[model samples]
Target: MKHTKVKDLLKSTTTLQEVNAKGWVRTFRNNQFIALNDGSTLNNIQCVVDFENTPDEILKRITTGAAVSVTGELVESKGAGQTYEIQVKKIEILGDSDPDKFPMQPKKHSLEFLRENAHLRVRTNAFGAIMRVRSVLAFAVHSYFQKKGFVYVNTPVITGADAEGAGEMFQVTSLPMDKLPKNEEGAIDYKKDFFGKHTNLTVSGQLEAETYAMALGQVYTFGPTFRAENSNTSRHLAEFWMIEPEVAFNDLNDNMDLAEDFIQYVIKYTMDKCGDDLKFLEGRLLEEEKSKPQAERSELALLDKLNFVLENNFKRVSYTEAIDILRNSTPNKKKKFNYIINEWGADLQSEHERFLVEKHFKCPVILFDYPANIKAFYMRLNEDGKTVRAMDILFPGIGEIVGGSQREERYDVLVEKMKVLGIDEEELSWYLDTRRFGSAVHSGFGLGFERLVLFVTGMTNIRDVIPFPRTPGNAEF
Candidate 1:
């Protein structure tokens, strides 16, 4: 009658008289033992079928990827891998999958091959574990913010402003491309568009979240953000989720403290809740790394790496100090890095960041007081006229896990900075309003959700963590 999840059934203390378990058949061995998984957990429950009594036709339909419901008695399993097994009394095929056509079989599949079959990839053990850990981490994000009395705000996905000041946003328009309307100067008339102005998908919700933070005192947004960048690197994703938290009356130090605590809290929470999944991923990573040389392998295991972050304080270093460290480092001195760090104002790349975290510091590092010219327009400019009160939290594997800064609260300085950057005063007047009226010092940072998943799950590729990754020239499910 009532179906029990595989995860719950496996943990049962007493044997049940009759239980209904529904899941896709992972494998049917010897026409008697069935490995069934319903995605509730990483492990599958063994379902033993009586092939002598079952019809041959029904047995033939019990193929891999086929959905089936087995009514059976839950008892102690004689199997070695699992503790519980289902003694099936009746078998019903909810959906039949042809063994010849099903893409995922009972065998090892490359991550690349699984990426190609994104829709059906979750049936595999690795993807299933990854998705479970991802779900738990997402919940942990909200739990951390909510428990801290932070108001959850939903910023508009479609906005007229580019929060990051990067022009690589996806344009949202309803106007016909071929029959485009033009102005007197032959420029495309945005007035005829749906929003009556040029609008793009938001790159960050930080600017909008600031408005709420000013009134609400503390606010956070967890939502989808889009970028039109064409890079196909393992770290870059055209579409990804960002978790941004903006707080009022906070400075650079307060922002750093908030970010460090928030990150550690979420990571610890994920580790606590997704213990089984994390263990599975740890083993998966260990197995995967066996193919590589010892020098290239990660020194710490997945769980240990996570616990290390929780146990240690993030080393706080200034941008100037980090630049000095990088400039004198072996890679930069020997011209090994792709981008040399010889100058002060040069933007730090991933290679430089990894060196700081993994090699030099050997722990998470927060580099602050960035050069003003390289940072966004909203960051507070330092009195020295060279740097801004900005910071980036660098992780060992993931370079920059979080980016934030103490916002420019002074209206005059903000206007002057916008004028210098050629940013439209009228276009972002709404954002300027926060500074214009009672703008106290406020700070916020955006954490790339996918990157967090990538780090926690120990998955190398960013595309592997997010479902149905949208990359350049590829949008297949």
Candidate 2:
């Protein structure tokens, strides 16, 4: 008989006399019951062994992490924890796991310890639930875009230009470090490199996605993005995934509408499809937060928080207005803010954003029209010549989840802005061609894919959401 997934068997309405199940053993209890997981869902199916009829050698091999296949009869479970379980008639050990050697036993493990063993961490209940939610959320992202007639674009992972203008990027080179070639002026010869010029892993796919959007009308890119920043924080990752959507003829207002609606839709879909996983994660979060002070604990439950986002509209405000509120805020007056908002044009930090979302507004906030000096060169300039048509969407727990702006469509304006910022116009002539030929007001935002996963999973650390996290100095397995 064909093997049935544990998820399907668990959801079965009728018990079967003959059924086959194959998975890795999670635990063996009282020499009779075996908990097995197949990565189909967060829940594991319990398999009851007839130990009196079974051999001692087979029972000893049924250790944690051991791969096993069992042919059994599905019956109503007598145990208190599960509704139904398998009555194993025949069992085979595909692989054996030594109890002394297995790192992940049926016990509680710290997140730090789990990070060290990331390759095998998926076997844990928390990690398994997180991965399932991540997969469902990813599908929701694709479904939301494709259903809206948006073309999915695969932008190149390697590019020749610094699209973000912030030059903290990882360089891709093929030349030997010890035996490097030099030019007449003793500079490293980039012509001999793989791309015949300096190139690096892309930090964002927005620029390339824009090219397609100009032609395709609507396009989105979902792919891995890399940065060489050395910050080792819970929120920073050297390599992460980014989801960027570009729409032609979209002004700042249109961009905001798209972002808000898109986020709500995908999150709702995940809530609908992955209800069991979300519930497990929600309980996990509550247990983890028990050590925190009462004041620091979340005011709403996980489901309530997610429902709040869908039920209410995000507060929209201008940068100037946000600055004014921050300047007079209690934190600013009490010197609690690490960097006080003393004047206008000051860049908003993570703390400031959290305050706006958690305390001041009590909801997600979309701040727009930021100072031109603080934003990117490609953002459309406001008539006041001081601020750009930029916006950032701040969430309750995760400060800035989305950032975007209306693109500068005029050739002369874009070129002048690039010149003022000391960017090489010749290097990005192809990008300029969009404005040179035909350009319209366009807008898009990039949502950090891992951050979205982190939010949905109720995971505090960004590293926990990603399977193999790449940080400043850690790249193990």
Candidate 3:
């Protein structure tokens, strides 16, 4: 008999007589009921077995994480939890999980312990819910752009250009590290490496995506991006997925509009499609927050928080205005901020961003028109000569969910800015050509895909959201 997926079986309006189901056993209760899940849905279909008729040998194999196939009659369940269940006629153990050796037992485990076994962590209810939400959100991201007539662009993972010029990039080389070839000046000769010049895993696809956007008019790139930064904070990851969208003839306002709509669309899509998983995660968050003080607990539930973002408009504030608000705020006044906001040019830290999003605005906030010296060189310089048309969308929990700006379109001004920033002009001549030839106003932003997942899944640590996270001093499978 053909196997019916757990998701479909649970959604069936009428129960069938003889249905085959295959899945891992989540738990065996009372030696009669087997909770089975096949990763199709968060809910498990209760499989009732006749313990008296079943042999002891077959019944003993029904341990957690064991794979099994059951031939049964799907019927309206009399059980309290599930609406439908399988009355097993025959069961076969495809694979057995030794309860003593299985790391994930039927009990609550610490997040750190689960992370160590990330390879098998998805089998857990929490991780399963998270990964499902992540998958749904990923599809939402693609669907949202595709429906908008945006071309999906595949940018190179390896590139010679440093989009941010941050110097913190994972260098890609094929030369022997122990016996690296040296030049006449005694410097390591990158000419002997792959690509005949220094190249690294791309930090951002924005630059290459811009090349396509110039011709395609509107395009977005969703792919893995590498950053060599060693920060081991909960928010930073060495390797992560990035979503970058570049559109031609867009100014700062258009960029903000695109970002706001894009985020809300994806979030709403995930919430709608993965309601079961989201509800589970919301309950999980509520339970986790119970240990904290009442005042520190979340004011709104996860679903409410998500809905609130979708319902309200993001508060748009200039960098200058944000600075004044921060300086006058209680945290800054009490010298509680780690990086105190003293002047306009001071970059906003996570503390400042959270305060604006969670405390003052009580909604997502868009901070724009940042100081040119503080923002990237590619950001469009405003007429004031001091600030750039940069924007960052700050979420309640996730500080900066999206960072983008109106690109500097003028050739001479861009070159001068690059020179002042000490960025090599010759290496980026290919990028500058877009501006040189026929550049109109263009803008884009890079959203950390994992952060979005973290927000949607209601997970605190960024590592928990991404599978097999690569953090500082940790690359375990």
Candidate 2 per-residue C-alpha lDDT over 304-338 given as tens digits, one digit per residue, 9 for 90 to 100: 77887788799999999999999999999999999
- TM-score, candidate 1, is 0.98
lDDT of 2: 0.93
Model 1 alpha-carbon miss at residue 130, Å: 0.9
Q: How many clashes in candidate 2? A: 0
| Ranking of models by lDDT | 1, 2, 3
Badly placed stretches (over 4 Å) of model 1 are none
lDDT of 1 by residue, 196-277 (tens): 9999998988888999999999999999999899899999899999999999999999999999999999898988888999
Backbone N/Cα/C clashes per model:
0, 0, 0
Name the 10 consecutive residues with the lowest summed lDDT in model 2.
163-172
TM-score of 3: 0.98
lDDT of 3 at 339: 89
The pairs that clash in candidate 1 are none
Per-residue lDDT of 1-477 in model 3, one digit per residue for the tens? Answer: 999999999999887678999999999999999999999999999999999999999999999999999999999999797889999999999999999999989899999999899999999999999999999889999999999999999999998878687548988899998899999999999888889999899888888888889999999999999889879788889999999999999999999999999999999989889998999999999999998899678777899889978999999999999999999999898998898888778878888998999999988999999999888899999999999999999988768999999999899999999998888989888899999888989999989999999888888899999989998888886
Consecutive 10-residue window with the lowest summed lDDT within model 1: 159-168
Q: Estimate each model's TM-score.
A: 0.98, 0.98, 0.98
* Global Cα RMSD, each model: 1.2, 1.0, 1.2
- For model 1, what is the alpha-carbon lDDT of residue 461? 99
The Cα local distance difference test for each model comes to 0.93, 0.93, 0.92
Winning model by lDDT: 1
